[model samples]
Target: MKAMIKVTLKNGVLDPQGKAIMGSLQSLGFNGYDNVRQGKYFELDIEAFSKEEAKARATDMCEQLLANTVIENYEIEIV
Candidate 1:
């Protein structure tokens, strides 16, 4: 099974990196984008018997290490 975890800063948290990216995009003539946010994308391969198991394990991975729950939120996708 394959799982993906996307981690992003929670609302109200200052994202300097995202701001910088927005500035760079505007400067490069890539306008029409606003309030841009950046995040982490992780792809994991797991040996699971079902999609539920894969997602559950990936959720655990996010809770334990992939994401900092205090400042970040994560979503899981299983394939």
Candidate 2:
């Protein structure tokens, strides 16, 4: 199975990197982008007998290391 994980800063969290990217885009004449929140996307392959098992493992992976749950939120999709 393949899993796609997306981790992103929670709302109200300060994202300096996102701000910098937005600034760079503006400098290059790319306007109308007021806010940009950067996130991480991870693809993984795992051996699981069932979708439920895969989801559980993927959730554990996010809680353990893939995302900082205190300041970030994550979503996992298994395929």
TM-score of each: 0.95, 0.94
Cα error, candidate 2, residue 60 (Å): 0.4
* Highest-lDDT candidate: 2
Off by over 4 Å in 2: none
For residues 1-79, what per-residue lDDT tens digits would candidate 2 score against the true structure?
9999999999999999999999899889997668899999999998999988999999999999999999999999999
Residue 3 C-alpha lDDT in model 2: 91
Per-candidate total of colliding backbone pairs: 0, 0
- lDDT of candidate 2? 0.95
Model-by-model lDDT, in order? 0.93, 0.95
lDDT of 1 by residue, 4-36 (tens): 789999999999999999999999999776998
